[model samples]
Target: MAYRRLSNQSLVGVLIVLVGVVLLVDTTGLYDTGFLLTYVPSLFVLVGLYALVSSDFRNVGGPLVLVTVASAWQLVALDVVTVGRILRFWPLLIVLVGLSIALGRVRPSVAEVDDDRFDLVAAFGGLDRRATSKTFTGGNVTVAFGGGELDLRDTLVPAPPARVNVVALFGGVDVVVPRDWNVRLDVLPVFGAAEDDRPRREAEHDGVDLVVTGFCAFGGVTVTN
Candidate 1:
């Protein structure tokens, strides 16, 4: 059979053996003491090994290795060898390290801004509050909102022919427009709904044309003119 990927347990066992050898040779005085004290070194070895296996070493491995080394130095400095002392604090250490690793895994999207427009895109893995807004020159504008709330409004300049394109996905989008402006809105099926509070009459003044599109998993969109 083809060789399968090694399990975390096997990796941990190898690391434990190596650490035990080093500890035994480096600290011969350990055997003179009771076995209860040996748990401290064992615990540190296990934690260091676990961190190495669980962490994404390629991208974040260097810092994590540094942390493990620092922790080992601290243990040596304090002479933490007693099993009772090790057990008393092991749970707290594990919890703290686990939480830190979890938080470090979170990544955010990149936002780019140019002279004429701003573009933002991100893959928010399940639990993220999407909130953003941008304003630029009212010429061929495009807006997209997905899986969250989007509020877009355009201020009409004294100039004529202001065109906007807006796209929203799966969530709610709200847009505000001038009272007396000629505007056109086209929404795809992906967008939940579109509403206009203003009366359905042609505006006497030249107004801004806003178009929006995007998708959301749960939230809805709202537009006001």
Candidate 2:
């Protein structure tokens, strides 16, 4: 039998369903699951772990920060530590940043890949790329303490919807698509913002549908035509 891995989209849908179920059960007042909310921060730990596994541990900086912040908050929520105590260790972020830089330098660099799909990363730098693939598929973009731009105005997707995951941590990403295309933004912003700045059109065009989804922590992702 062939093994099939779950896509992030499916995983997110499952989580949403589960959350709805939990909320429904809570409304009945038969059992108290309110305490479970305290563990909500742990979701970031899961996200970090997933990112590590999915990227074969190549994408580290942003995920590591997510896990660290979530862990600190979890500890405080559980009454295991106080907010004051955690604040004292906040300087460790500087150390983590240094480690991330060192690890990035040691990692092997990848040459430019096919235009159909890409895995672009901008860590402590800037990245600008344009996609012109006729069979344009979805791809990923990660920005950590840096900026990135993915211009797909000249690209043509064979399919209707292409899913692109963008992660911005202490940085920002700009996605430029064709004016005729429609964008579905489902990104989560934590102390940040994600905006779709495309001009409103009265009639829909027969262009590709782009689904932009991911996390923005202390950063932003802007989609424009």
Candidate 3:
């Protein structure tokens, strides 16, 4: 038999049927212990179907279902699903769902430009820079600029350290360099502080240079090595 897609309304109807089934089973005192475990997969299927059918779903219901399922799974995993606990977490879950839906509406466009060097610019407010052609083997590279963020974390290659230069106008920045690589940071007057929590020196390895500059009207910056 071939699989068939269910509409959002049909999925909701199916969910209602499943809930009725659970209620009937509970009243009969049969397999009561695994009720939630048995229903979670069904609920996930219904939510997935709902997300597929409704174009406006992701902007509204998708996040709500996701947060609800995640919360339920956590509670079931910890074996702590009491009525009071569920009630207490419900409001927080609603807030998370609402926030996710609101944020999803603000979509940002990303573009990659290639030139003489490995230049990656996510210009939200027209900031520009050129990255040097250095071998950045094993390290984490993170660049956040102008309400946009970029992270190249946990590279498995075993090459030399990396160098990064960034400029931000009104956003946040965070980067993590490898412990073995040597690193230097230069920030312009517009750029804010260079916050790093890594140790002064590590074992045998060289760091890289990390320079950041911007007009951070309401921006923050961070870099680590």
Candidate 4:
């Protein structure tokens, strides 16, 4: 198989550049320490931009934009808003996810696709959701300094196999797939580990295959049935 560089690799590079710039500014005494954290939310917007341009990841970009802006709002409210009051705004994720799914980013009439692909991201937070695709093709999962739970156990896959690409940096990702399917682990972890929990005997020739491939940097990947 030909090696395909993931489109989100650009997003990862941009994040690294942003972090470097922030450090350089702080080193030059141009900005204080906490200053960098405030602009951290913009990382999502940057990722959203990358996704917006990618044919496969466009559907996920909008939700990332919305979540980033809402998270930034919470940061701005730090002066007058109480912790509880700020926490109340957390429900915006549910609303945004619903809206994104309702107003899908992918077209229903697209060829070779049974359903539109969606993106899931978790940055300094957690995500727990499922896909509505009957013949789920594939999507991306990104976690930066946070945790994410992607439940695809209920997803129908009349298609033979699907890919779920993941990138976890200083975070954790838990992928839940159907019990009867076979999970192929093709991940490379640098200061982390990827565990495939599917039963070897039962899932030997499996109904379908889920290829879990990606890189984990100082993070973890857990696959469960």
lDDT of each structure? Answer: 0.40, 0.76, 0.44, 0.67
Residue 3 CA displacement from its true place in model 2, Å: 10
Identify the candidate with maximal lDDT: 2
Positional deviation of residue 202's Cα in model 1 after best superposition, in angstroms = 4.3
Name the lDDT of candidate 3.
0.44
Estimate the TM-score of every prediction: 0.31, 0.52, 0.33, 0.55
Query: What global local distance difference test value does model 2 have?
Result: 0.76
lDDT for each residue of candidate 4 in 77-189, tens digit (9 for 90 to 100): 44545666666767776776776566554544121323546555555444555666787887888777667777787677667578888888898898888777777778899
For model 2, residues 97-147, the per-residue Cα lDDT tens digits are 788778778865322334777776555455566777888888878776767
* Candidate 3 residue lDDT tens string, 32-146: 8464755464455444444423323323344355546655766665567765666666677677667755755673322222222233322222122222223333211222223
- lDDT, candidate 3, at 209: 34
Clashing pairs in 3: 181-206, 181-207, 182-206, 182-207, 182-208, 183-208, 190-214
Error of 2 at 172 (Å): 7.2
Model 4, stretches more than 4 Å misplaced? Answer: 1-9, 17-115, 201-203, 206-208
Local accuracy of candidate 1 as per-residue lDDT tens digits, 1-225: 899665433444475486677567557864443343444544554454444343322113323443554565556546765545545655555565565566557734221223233222211111122223233433221122223222233343334443333333333444455555455554444425555556743354444444443332233334455
Clashes of each: 21, 0, 7, 0
> Order the candidates by TM-score, highest first — what do you get?
4, 2, 3, 1
The parts of candidate 3 lying over 4 Å away from their true place are 1-118, 121-146, 156-161, 201-218
The worst-scoring run of ten residues by lDDT in candidate 4 lies at: 105-114
